[model samples]
Target: MADTEKTAIAAHLYVALRRVANRVIDIEWMAQNEEYARAIIKFAVEQGNEELARQALRYQALLDGEPAPREASARAEATPPSADTVKKRYIGTLR
Candidate 1:
């Protein structure tokens, strides 16, 4: 593809990503219209906009009351209580 065409497509993805991020595009549509959402996300991935695609998925997961996989994994890595702390807190219950 020509440089201009690539730039234009990138700009389009940027706008779409921003619209969803800013809530201007009603991300709830992602949940209600799965095909449309998948098309947007697929285009983003094809164009190498993985982060934008991920953001779109995150929006959908948020609408569904769940964390996106990356977000969940990141949370799991964030702050696990130490084994000692858990043991101390649950000592009586464990016994």
Candidate 2:
């Protein structure tokens, strides 16, 4: 295959993988399996691929009733906070 064709094929595969990951996470959530849900997100994040991570995040948001994964208060608390997050919390407390 040509370089362009190969790139396109890879892009398509990434999208398909993201869709599958999202579905799996959703099913785990509906089953009330928080551990499995976290596992899915961890897998996606560890894959270091944007699409997979985004899909995992989307599923997390859906499970948490948030607009986005970053807005998931429970998930956010479990994960380590970033520098900016710490700053935000400190700033909020000062108000």
Candidate 3:
């Protein structure tokens, strides 16, 4: 990736991580309320912050005394759809 793209990605990753960490701390401070935890995860996923979603999942695992889910590697391996795919889907919807 170009330096600019790399920087943008890094910034986004940091923000997502921060949000996840904050949510986790909030849950802990709230006495491990399941409702609060679920709300955080749902909001993260709904906002298309996959990193945050994964972090929330890991938090839940740890809360249950299980191993946290594998990190960075799993996300890095998944390919997002290309512009061509999006264009095709958009055109199809016009039919």
Candidate 4:
């Protein structure tokens, strides 16, 4: 989509985001309307808006009454050791 369209879409998401934050709109309702919530998250990701996407996901988790996801360090701790963990094959895979 054109830049103008993306901006407009982002603007709308901002309004929706505010509505969620201010509790003018029920979060449970938004959570039930999964597509709408996902739209904001997807847009943020597509636009390279990492902060926005992270916040949106956190809010969505709250709305859904789900536990927030673990932080990166915690995730690392939870991860099972891979074969050849010492070498860490993925470190070279990106090259």
Query: Could you say which candidate leads in lDDT?
Result: 2
- Segments in model 3 whose C-alpha atoms lie over 4 Å from true places: 1-27, 63-65, 73-95
The digit string of per-residue lDDT tens for model 4 on 1-95 reads 22323333345446655654432333343444657656656554455455556556655554456654433466667677733374465775844
In order of appearance, the predictions have TM-scores of: 0.36, 0.38, 0.40, 0.33
* lDDT (Cα, tens digit) per residue for candidate 2, span 1-95: 12323233234334645575543324423235657656656676677676666656665665465554343357657778754566678764875
Model 1, 1-95: lDDT tens digits are: 22323233344445766654442333345445657656666655554455666555554454355644443345546668744466588867865
Task: lDDT for model 1, please.
Answer: 0.51
Report the C-alpha displacement of residue 43, candidate 2, in angstroms: 1.0
Task: State the TM-score for model 2.
Answer: 0.38
- State the lDDT at 72 in candidate 2: 37
The window of 10 residues in a row where model 1 has the poorest summed lDDT is 1-10
lDDT of 3 by residue, 1-95 (tens): 12323233334434675665543234333233656555655566665666766655665564466665555565545755643465578764865
Higher-scoring candidate on TM-score, 2 or 4: 2
- For all candidates, the clash counts are 0, 0, 0, 0
Error of 3 at 13 (Å): 10
Q: Which candidate should be chosen as best, given TM-score against the real structure?
A: 3
**Ranked by lDDT, top first:** 2, 3, 1, 4
Whole-model Cα lDDT per candidate? 0.51, 0.52, 0.51, 0.50
Candidate 1 regions exceeding 4 Å error are 1-16, 19-25, 53-68, 72-76, 79-95
Clashing pairs in 1: none
